[model samples]
Target: MSKKSPERTPPESLHLPRVGVETHAHLDSREFRDDLPQVLDRAAASGIAAMGQVFLGPEAYQANQALFDSHPEVFFLLGVHPTDADKFTDATLAAMDAAFASDARIKAMGEIGLDSYWKDVPPETQHRIFRAQLALARERDLRVVVHSRDAFAETLAVLDDMGFKDRPLLWHCFGGDEAIARELLSRGWLLSIPGPVTYSKNVELARAVAAVDMDRLVVETDCPYLTPEPWRGKRNEPALAVFTAARIAQLKGLSVEDAWRHMGQTAAKFFGLELPK
Candidate 1:
């Protein structure tokens, strides 16, 4: 689904009786520009203690770097998104290498993987770019956030081609079946669930979420995109992650606190991220 801005303001901050850590969000998106402070506050007010952001371009990345400096509670995953694969170049990769070298807040080189579904960029070019970034992530010993669409099998082959030993590889906005989830689990990869699981028509995706081992599960909003239910049509934000966490709780038969604790710890361990001091 294409990303869009939500029209409603933050719902009254619900006390979720849990610590919701948003594993993925696009705080850098233009959607949040006008009311960025309100968005961040609403997230905090709504019980989202921490959030991980995916940086798509220089403009967004630069803005996020500034946000990180100003808000230590916010962390990031930096990389050229698959849609922007055409922009990948030797110089850009070099600059990214430097950023990875210097920045400790960059938790992963991410939101990077194959996207045959869109196919905006040529397959060959995308492969080259994906492999290059994978190499960089491996070299830096950083976690890799993958965004695979209808290209899961092909993505798996590419990942396998690399010496991708048990590194922290997260499949963000996971929209796969149980079989796919099993394969990812077998590879010792983690899956980040998004707001769509709350939708009624997504039984297969819901089953996948239920099938995911607690240790391998993390929650995401993919904000400015998949806003959770009760507010499905509204624009997504970090605060709404609580609903996703709550849904996981319902599916797992655990309390929201338990789900958040497990998912939060799993994400923190995988990304080597820490709660803000």
Candidate 2:
């Protein structure tokens, strides 16, 4: 009989009781429907202290309301993504308001900036919904998670028009260069570094990681997408956020423990999250 090969284990650090939280994720995505419990357990084992499950819109809110309760380690941010701009309506806003009013589990408002790359949603329509959501966030006294892609200038302009400067903003999966990072930092915005930073070809991202103030740093998997290196083509889960944290540590000249703490604690404070002490 042939001998069986050993299963490969993930890269790990011996840092005691590490503080690694996935600041952004999509726990309700169909990707986790089959084995969410297993995924969350694996994340805990991988040193994930907490995670934020960002809701896409009304449909996502309906499907995801109970996920945060199921795991105390998981918090949520509710908003309409730019792709779902067409779904923004008075009824949807009512549902979002009810979600915030009824449940203290929801933390912030967004993942709601602009995505010009997917042109099917017209720029005008996207601007309208995005601005409306920003107004709602301000009215509710909530922080904002901004997602800008292929429309950086326009996205920045829109936010500027909305007078979001000096507001509590978390720039999700920041893909900009150091210049943009500097701009965001000047505005007192936090950046959630994602898995793409681990890629060999992303030198600029590495530079941005090094350039940003550590106080403004946080980590996220943005999964079931942007799976980090070594797991590039596979679907990602929150457990894998440690790898991204490790990469950030490598770039920032921080020990794995320190890097994890900076990112995780930054997120905790920004979202007013409560992780087990």
TM-score of every model? 0.92, 0.94
lDDT of 2 by residue, 66-174 (tens): 7656688888888999988987898988888888888787889988999988988998999999988888888888899999999888988988888899999999998
lDDT of 1 by residue, 1-23 (tens): 99875554344444654356788
What shift in Å separates residue 211 of candidate 2 from its native position after superposition?
0.8
Where is model 2 more than 4 Å wrong at Cα? 1-18
Winner by TM-score: 2
Q: Give the number of colliding residue pairs in candidate 2.
A: 0
lDDT against the true structure, per candidate, is 0.82, 0.85
- What clash count goes with each model? 1, 0
The local distance difference test score of model 2 is: 0.85
Judged by lDDT against the true structure, how good is candidate 1? 0.82
